[model samples]
Target: MKKRLIGALLALTFCVPATAGDITPRLSPTPEQAQAAYLSAMFLSRYHYTVKPLDDALSEQIFERYLKALDPEHLFLTQADIDAFADTRKQLDDAILQGRLSIPFALFLRYEERTAERLGYARSLLAQNFDFSQNEHYPLDRSKAAWLKDDAEARDLWRKRVKNDWLRLRLAGKDAAAIRETLDKRYTRLLANSQKSKSDDVFQTFMNAYAGAIEPHTSYLGRGSAESFDIAMRLSLVGIGAVLQERDEYITIRELSPGGPAIRSGKLAVGDRIVAVGQGDGAPLTDVVGTRVEEVVKLIRGTKDTPVVLDILPADAGPDGRHTLITLIRDKIRMEEQAAKKSVLPAGDGRRIGVITLPTFYEDFEGRRRGDKDYRSASRDVARLIDELKQDKVDGLILDLRNNGGGSLREAVDLTGLFIDTGPVVQQRRADGKINVESDSKAGAAWDGPMAVMINRGSASASEILAAALQDHGRALIVGEPSFGKGTVQSLINLDQVARSDTPKLGELKVTVAQFFRVNGGTTQLKGVTPDIRFPSAFEGDEFGETRFDNALPWRQIDPATYRPANEIRAILPELTSRHATRANQDKAFANLREDVAELIKLKEKRNLSLQEAERKREKDSREARLRTRAEADGTAGPGDDGLQSSERSLSAELAAEKAFKARKDVLLEETARIVGDEVSLLAGSKRLAVGN
Candidate 1:
């Protein structure tokens, strides 16, 4: 197998563009090159798993899919070019099937030339228009239509755009020489960073193209990204915990950390685009469109307690999107924010339910690396929390993994152990088809009380593993929406380890070399774990599930592992479902949640418009005029009617009443605590059996 793999890699090197710099240059493939590379790599990899040797027909199909992904609209390719490429398709297919890596250097050179030409064109535009206000303004979705049609047209548009951009920057009082220097420096850094990546650039590129062909959510994490993954799992960063990705010219929000300032503010949404950022009030907002994610991160992150304001253009806003200035005070991330937070909820009929909200299975990597005696790990923390909850004498436990994207696999297994006697928590099936059963590897159950695990479309990976294990073993009742169905396991292989020398600077590559299977022989691939009692979640749209993703692995079953049911949890599920339904229907908070989701859906569906369509927009905007007018009026108004008839009136009687109410609420934390305590007592029914007792 190793020999075959090495043979394949050698063949791949021949197909890949050769390194041309003192340091091995990791280059981006042109549209044509990307299509060829993607086809060859995907076919080879899939064939390695499915067939004894690569087949010619499969290679042709792979080529077709690759081309379709790269140029689906067929706008970029002319009839002659398509015909010419089609004529050579057979030979290319044979080369890939035969594992003949030696593609002509001329082809690679062409790819290099194309890439250089594109970069040079982009640089020319930057040279001409630094400010970029007037080249051509089109909606993000329409950008490809406008610019990526033909080389000549694209070049012309870029030239004009760049000229206008530079003019604007000059107008803004930036020195041209300094700007040029900065650009050069940034480009150098980017190239250097790319070179430092340890993973095979060709393979990483193939994965990226494969992911792009599938869906936005499916991504291949290169070696450099493994560090990022570690950071994400740890939930610790110097900057604001918002992940952004370039979608067209704008940087779109990819994910929001559970306890990040952005989530706390409740203003920034996943689809919002960041246009500009300011260091402080009245500071010039720097346009960051088309900037690298790292540069954007640098701009957004600041020293603790320093405020950085972002001018966001929400996806739902019109073409010239409305600007929302969000101010966040930066600080070092707290690991606890990403851990499970425990609370006692009144589950009526004298039952105090322990609610453990697992935001994400987090681990403090930096602290652990530093050998801190009290370094935090998710499983340990959760285990302690479960013990505490048990001591509180809670009758039932609700492990809420809603919106959790998963984390450390070890932690997941350990967390699952807390519910049942030691058993296999998950099955890891490697590329070689060897299945490793990962068991609890720990002592007795921490809290074996009636358990309900809540999941949603966002509950993925390790989260899915835990939920599926608990449900399969009858240790818990799965509730809420279906899990995210990301059952693959990615192993972060340090490129440095593979390198010939220790000081070699190649980064890392996190490849999905294995797929996870559940103890019951079920794989949570495209078919996620279905809840025992499904509940409505905010993200229930048709487009949001794993099933919507193209190329997602199909769900299958394996042999179920033997395990004893912790308790008769299913018998109580029906009653629990009924009770939850009744309570949810009557709960004001739940109603509010539904309303919020509806409103958010409405907001996200809005689109951009041309200046000519502004009038029509205004007509539509009139219906919302009352709300806008009320807000505008509120900005200038004092407290209430003071009968002074002045432009700005003093605080009024009604205003005083509102302020008094706010003050009372502010001082009523103790009262609120007392109320919660009473509710807890009433729910527990004087059990005196555990901790709260």
Candidate 2:
């Protein structure tokens, strides 16, 4: 099945236009196309200086790719336009071939006009009650929303959003009069920026959509902005350790890094809206409503120990608004916290267990590029860790690959070899119908112990490969939530090679090139790998998985490859499962987890704001009641201890619960160790019996 999938993907590479039956017909270049190309050339000329001689051919290709990305369904361009663009395409190609130094400015104006027109249309659509709050805590049903039914209402909403955006630009210090005066000049400069940025954005978007279409693991990162580049290179950012997304006019926290200031503060919740920001006490709050995401990010981020205050609009806040001012001290992000870490668990049965938490399969590419031998690579480090664990005489190993977004294909294959003996790890199929089998070439396994893999919706790409391969080969039992289904391959193509100019310049392009399949013939595209024993995880919402994607490839299976099981680990599967079930059923930690999930769900359901005076009071009362309930449930106070009051007892209990939870996880490790020990003993017994007979 893996081979077939690879073959199919490869076939797409060389497929002629004639063979792409029912595909939207290619349109000729429009005036917009010519302008877009010219802008791209200008951007490339300014920033990308390594590849001298920007040319028309390269620009034409970039334009065509950009157009295709913008209108993949072929709904925007007509056949006549396609034909009309032919000459322009050829002219661009010829100029690129000759390495032309100059491009006309008139082309940039057309590009600007087209882009603004398109953005205007998008802005107009955003006005209606399309419900930007779908992924927020109070998830809205667009069908039930009255605003969605009225086009006028929707357009008005978008217009207001646009107005707010302009206001934000002004706040960012853009002089209104100067902006008006330099509109043409800025557009001209932006045309060049846009051209360069278009190539970068289009390539990145395509990679994202393509990887997302294949599975969630595969992703593309074009050359980032100067700020982003600095962050990636340094593996650090100055901000509260959280990723934010815009839903409607509010900024919502999307991801929280472990041990980050936001997580440590215990104040800001995932669904809370950041409505305003202030520098310090007595500073007037700056309303950040409807701001561009990056601009907002800049305001929030700062150097370590510098404080930034946020006016948080809780998910359930009413119109009069119940907001909290949260001041967080910015700090340098710790890359080590984001990488894989190891822990040792001591079982009551005198067995030792090794647990490894893999946050992500991250690679410091810039570090690698600079020829750093000790630069972090997930697979290499993991393999070394496994060896160290074995040397420490650990009886079992639990690989926590939860929330791992894959990196480096080579690393994934190598990691798979650590668990399984020589076998095909994954199959890669290209667009030209070629299938390549990625395999583990190693001779021996690193840790042949009782092994289990923990996964969640965030586990993708190479993470999927390791989990799927282990499960398929019967090497490990998968636990926790289902893995993120993301099985695609991307290739980074340097556009500098094709540029047409003497001033070494051209951006890079990342294109989706293939799809990946596991050894058992299943593609973890839309439906991620289901765990052997499912456990509730942090990402329970619908928005985080591949199913949320509109164009994700459907999950399918092919013929399984021939491979022998390392050992009959399944013989003790029943006992292991029974033990786990018993432990979980009686586990207070598990019980608390369930309660937490329920409370979160309830909190997320609140939406409508109270407008009337009486209603506002009621709303406030209701919010207070909910908060009290939450405090009581999660607080440390316990029942009747003379020295400690109820509040103190609740705090003590909470602390105890955390300690117990960690202990319970260790118990789980011990149980796995016992299972592995039993298996090893049974094998020895059978061998002795056979010899005696």
Best by lDDT: 1
**What tens digits encode model 2's per-residue C-alpha lDDT throughout 1-693?**
134433433333222121111111221222222222333333234322122244554445544543455545332233443554556554543332232312212232333444554345544443333232222121223322332223344344334433333332333355555333333333333333333333335334433432233223334344445346445434567788877765544676756777888989999876677888887667788888766567678888887888889999876676468889999988877666656678777654576768788766656666678998877667767887887888888877788886677666777887878877678888876646467788887776776656788777878878888888887777887777887777776554333333322432333433455778888777887777888777655465256777765555556666656566544556666766676678667766556566556765665565532223344345445655655664586552222212221222333354465566555433334444444444444344432110000
RMSD of each: 13.4, 14.7
Per-model clash counts, in order, read 24, 52
How well does model 1 score by local distance difference test? 0.58
Give per-residue CA lDDT, model 1, range 1-693, as digits (tens): 244643544444344343221222343333323323433344335532222233455445444544454344433333443444565445544443333323322223233444455445656544542323322442313312422545675565445434433433343345778556544444333333333322234434434544444333334554446556776677566667776775544677867877778888888887788998899778899998767666678688767778888999987876586788888878676555566788876644566777788887877767878998876777778888888988899877778787888888878887888776677889988768888899875666787655577778889888999999988787767777878778887554343343322552334434455678988888988878898877555565245767765556666777876565543455455655565567667755455446546765664554432222234335345534633554474432123212122211222333455566545321112212222233334334332211110
Against the unseen true structure, what C-alpha lDDT does each candidate score? 0.58, 0.56
Worst 10 residues of 2 by lDDT: 16-25
Query: Model 2 lDDT vs. the true structure?
Result: 0.56
Model 2 vs. true fold: TM: 0.53
Model 1 regions lying over 4 Å from their true place? 1-207, 210-220, 234-336, 343-353, 363-375, 387-395, 430-434, 503-507, 537-542, 587-693
Q: Model 1: how far is 436 from its true place, Å?
A: 3.5
